[model samples]
Target chain A: MRLNGNRSFSSFSFLALASLLALFLFFVTLLLSVFLYVGPRELASSLLSEEILFSIRLSLITATMATAACLLVAVPAAYALSRFNFRGKGLVDVLLYLPIGMPPVALGAALLIFFGTPMGGIFSARFVFEVPGIILAQFAVISALATKIMKSTFDGIDPEYESVARTLGCSRFQAFYKVALPLAKGGLITAVAISWIRALGEFGATVMLAGATRMKTETLPVAIFLNLETADVVKMSAAVLILAGVGLTALILIHKLGKRWPAV
Target chain B: MIRVENLSMRLGNFALTDVNLRVQRGEHSIILGPIGSGKTTLLKCIAGIYRPDSGRIEMDGEDVTELPPERRNIGYVPQDYRLFPHLTVSENISFGLRVRRSGNLEDRTRAMLDLVGLSDLSRQCIKCLSEGQKQLVALARALAIQPKVLLLDEPFTRLDSTAKVRLRRELRRIHEQTGVTIIHVTHDFEGSLNSRNRVAIMNDGRLVQDLSEIKKYLDEKLGYIPIDLRAGG
Candidate 1:
């Protein structure tokens, strides 16, 4: 009887400690209530609206392009940082992390200032406040995170792989492409997925660099904000749902397709 | 022939100094060193994996000091057998030929497959391979390049006793069949020191130039009384 009394109190304390999880469940369920409040037909029509569709299309296209550009530059940068210890490497590493630490809006402001320079003036005239500006903004902020992920990934792998590959008659570039790149498969997928989501959800940089021009440069996040300005709750909710849905889908696909690459 | 003259390198805190050796063409030499004695550093310098400091490396009587690894054609098998986990055993073996665009790629790969006796497991992914199999794959991959010299760094470290004995025999056979200059590094004395292969002893990043000093050196420092000393002489 005494033992049972002690166990009952411990179990109660354990259940009380789970309060944060219960709170999170309550919030998620409440957020999901938006789909129920609006009729399914109305939600489907809002989803199919031309304006909403354009935002979706633009967001997907620009985010994908940015992620690809980020990958090309980040792969080598990450490998070098992971493997080499050269002069000023410490400074370079710290500088790479600066973006991840700083606010995206600050990065956007710096990019905007750069565009006014003689070198960037012509480029900005052509692309700034345009679709390309959105991509640039997303790439600037997201690549740092991607590079970090990739560097850590490369760090986990041994350097002897490259050394062995080199002695197997592979040139440095061949060794990287054939061995290092293949071994970095799982990390690549994670980097791309995370960068893609980051690009998709980017707002601060895009708003500052591209400006939320309706039907011109507005992404899904911008659309939600724009609808809020006009007090269009339905359209804002629709935009919110779209963003959440896309993120959920991406995560699911990553989870499923990630199996193709053998886990380390 | 492969020759090292005054080879020195500083990889982080560890230093290899004034290491020198010359292995004749078609010679099979084993370098037995204590752990952390820069056996790998010397091998890497030979393979051009790491640039040597204050020294020269020559292969086939040519100063390969300025040559890159690919140009030197030194087949290296690292201790851990860093096989590309994404590739099949077949792809791993044929990687060298594929990189060079060798037209006889299939025949060379098949020969290596048969040589390593891993033909049945050729199609399997590297992640699924055993440690012994990975070691063989690494060896085959290195040899497929038809390198002028083969540098193996503790290739038998992770193998079982039975596997080690079998691989030692296989290494000897391969040495005879290929006639390639070979330098194999190991931390074991009894296993690596054999009569057929010429042996070099290393301690604390330096190789013993005069074998006459080995007994006193071992007895006073390393504390090893070799079996030959116990022959009742």
Candidate 2:
């Protein structure tokens, strides 16, 4: 076993690896124990209840809408950042990253203040503390992440693909849509899934802006928090199960969609 | 006919200075040079991909120096073949005509595939093609629109000896059939250039010679005489 190795890392590497794995299992086991302790009866009955069902439905719809809004803005923004030279390019990048760098509650408060202004008041009356507010808050919290993923995706493609398309008779916009977008299909799926999942579990901004109105604006994450306030552990456990089930199903669905395009 | 008058630009470490040449209609010309020799840069400028800071590119007596690439009906195939991965072979061939909203999409695509002898692989994805097949797909896509001029950068760079022989034969056949003017760039002169084709030699970003003396450059052993070697002590 010691063919010129001199025991350099043989024993220490094994011990260090075991130590790291133990630490990983510590967190995972801690989370799993809660599900087991909550028992199947509590998980099943609470999950099937009307209030939890409404929260789950509202959460899924808002997350889906937020991800769509994120993609609508981020796709072009990321493409421009990847493939063009323009004034204030660096400033635009900084603006995109501001929400990600700050806490979500700060962004929610800032949005609240801006929406309260005279000019923003018209739309604010309809947006603030409503279902629209939930979608807007989730969108704000997740768009930076989506933009970041998409920018990296566009950067990986050779800009020559677009150049070649243009010389092949495609206009600039046509080239982007026909070539770049299709080639980036896999990356776009990942970006959307990440946005959807992040929005699904968003807590701070959702609670601040959407106001957790029972049976109305209450998303799954807000339902969990409200359950905690009332010491309703069974309902909270069911909400966690719903979020986990939704996240896994979304990823699997997107993975299948990504297979349809199958970028080389 | 195609003409370039005083084409010059600076791209990274390379600078092409005051290059001028003319290619007559239906004539096939080859530009020979080593790597980083500004051959691709010159072609890109002519294709309208890179705007040369100073120059004029005229095709069929119309100035296309400032026209966007889409407006210029020139077919260009880069060395790597840049085929759209998501598109099938037939889709790739029809991409050009589809973009231009040209009539007879299916007819033109079938003709191009038949010309390249890829009629059987019409629905195959690009990833499934052999290197030689990919090259043909790139060529077919470019030709679908019936461009007045065609430019190929290193058309036969990375190919097996068998594939190289076949591609050369195919290219020669296509040129004869279409009568389209072509400007092919490559490093191989002995195998790629001939008396029927005009040749230009480039070094360090300058056109050293436009083969005003063709025989002088064709002999591989005699072509590479360093200026200092011929200089007297």
Strongest candidate by DockQ: 2
lDDT (10s digit) by residue, model 1, range B163-213: 888888888888888888899998887776444677777888888756665
* lDDT string, candidate 1, A33-92, tens digits: 877777778878888888889999999999999999999999899999998889999999
List model 2 lDDT by residue over A1-93, tens digit each: 353545576677779778999999997786697698799888889999998999989998999999999999999989999999899999999
TM-score of 2: 0.89
Chain A TM-score across all models, in listed order = 0.90, 0.89
DockQ scores for all the models shown? 0.72, 0.73
* Model 1 docking tier (incorrect/acceptable/medium/high): medium
The whole-model C-alpha lDDT of candidate 2 against the native structure comes to 0.86
Worst 10 residues of 1 chain B by lDDT: B224-233
Q: What's each prediction's TM-score?
A: 0.93, 0.89
Q: Give the poorly placed runs of model 2, Cα more than 4 Å off.
A: A1-31, A116-122, A253-264, B193-195, B208-233
* Model 2 CAPRI rating: medium
